[model samples]
Target: MTLATKITLVRLALIPLYAWLATRYGSSVSAGQPDEPFRLAAMAVFLTAGLSDALDGWIARRFNQHSALGRVLDPLADKFLMLTALIVLCVSPWSAQHKVPFWFAGLVVLRDVLSSLAAWAIWHRHGRVRISPHWTGKVATVLQLLALGWVMLQLHFPPSWIVMPAAGLFTFASGMCYIAEGWRQFHHGPPPP
Candidate 1:
């Protein structure tokens, strides 16, 4: 495996640690005793994973280490990380005071589910699916990550009131864009290479 893919694997490995720390912290907070150390550790792990995402991508491009495995694993790691973080922070009682809004999380989940289903359906019918990442989707991802960090770090300065809804809008917009792309591909065919 390439060094970039190895880095991506490390990011995936960190997810479980982040989850454990976050869960422990949440449990402590629910018990009316917040665990600051666990919370900080979770944040550190999360930030490391997030930064490694960028680092790996840069390495793949800069060092010419791109591979089919990297393409697949990178997005899989991102989805797993985001979904895990969203569920843990939003559903946990510890984050009752400052959690990602349920609606926003729902939007993100719904978008991804629908996108995956659409791709599958198209591939099943046409034997292939052409999925080009849209700019809006990229923006939504960055916004979602920022929102996650804001919540995880317990940043109350600007508040979730400002963060989540903005993320939701982009999430919705990107979902629509993907839906339209899927519809076109389904009816016509995968675009030419």
Candidate 2:
């Protein structure tokens, strides 16, 4: 495996770690326990994981180490971490106030799920459809990472009001774009090789 893919796998490995820290700390905070230390640890882990995502992508491109596995695993890790964080923050003692709002999280998850289904259907029909990542999807991802970080700050509430909804909108729009593009691909066949 390429170093790039290895880095991406490390991110997948961190998902369980992120979940454990978020849940352990989140439950404590919800129970009204003093857990700033734990909260800070969660934040550190989140930021590190988030930053590492960018780093790995850059490494893959810079060194021409791209692989099919990297393409699949990188997005999987990202979506898993995002969905996990949103659900954990929204439901748990981690939130200072209700956050990652239900609609926001739902819309985000729905977009991802629907997009995945569309891709799978297209692939099942055509085989080896390389649906390039959409630009809007990247925008949605950045906004989500920002929102996740903002929520983790735990010193803020109002910004989430702005960020999560916008992220949801972008996510939804991107999903539509993917669906349309995938449909076009299936109907028209993959673009000129």
Candidate 3:
């Protein structure tokens, strides 16, 4: 019900719009087709969603509007957006050289699936727990989003290969960090109060 949560909800709403724009109108500006209104609109929607990810988080933290719902929905929105973008990038021919490599996308997808299951199991058993994400997890997500946006916007200055591998590595590392943290929490209980 807070403003931060409202912003998060807006982001959740944008997910399908982003996906629809990306898949329904995805195309390559680098491929020189010219006259790409759909592609342009898709990029705009994607960029807006990407920026809103950070904005909503800042709103929650800066305004002290964090809630249990915010904690839950924030990560859910993030994962959904990332999953949708990855799949669309892999499937669409939207870029000359920035399309996601399947291996990288696959690793990210696999990590997310496992993490979701682990989190769900923990939640079901423990009830309403809010685990802080690792720094590496945050980095991984930023890298992934930057990569996706770069590909979406058709910017090649940083290039996909450099960004994608780093994204994958950070994502895997964060997953491992979460596993270790989960082990500690499940066995040891929430670290001191």
| RMSD in Å for all candidates | 1.1, 1.9, 2.8
TM-score of each: 0.96, 0.89, 0.83
Off by over 4 Å in 3: 27-35, 61-63, 127-130
Candidate 1 regions off by >4 Å?
none
How high is the lDDT of residue 119 in model 2? 74
Tens-digit lDDT track for model 2 on 9-108? 8888877787788788888877778578777887877777787888899999999999989988988888888898988877764655635677877888
Output the number of the TM-score-best candidate: 1
lDDT of 3 by residue, 82-131 (tens): 88889988887575586888887898888878776776776676663447
Error of 1 at 184 (Å): 0.5
The whole-model lDDT of each prediction reads: 0.91, 0.80, 0.79
In model 1, the Cα lDDT at residue 149 comes to: 82
Residue 8, model 2: Cα distance from true site in angstroms: 1.3
Q: How much is the lDDT of residue 115 in candidate 3? A: 71
Q: Which residue pairs in candidate 3 collide?
A: none
Candidate 1 at residue 162, lDDT? 86
Q: Give one clash count per candidate, in the order shown.
A: 0, 0, 0
Error of 1 at 42 (Å): 0.5
Against the true structure, candidate 2 reaches a TM-score of 0.89
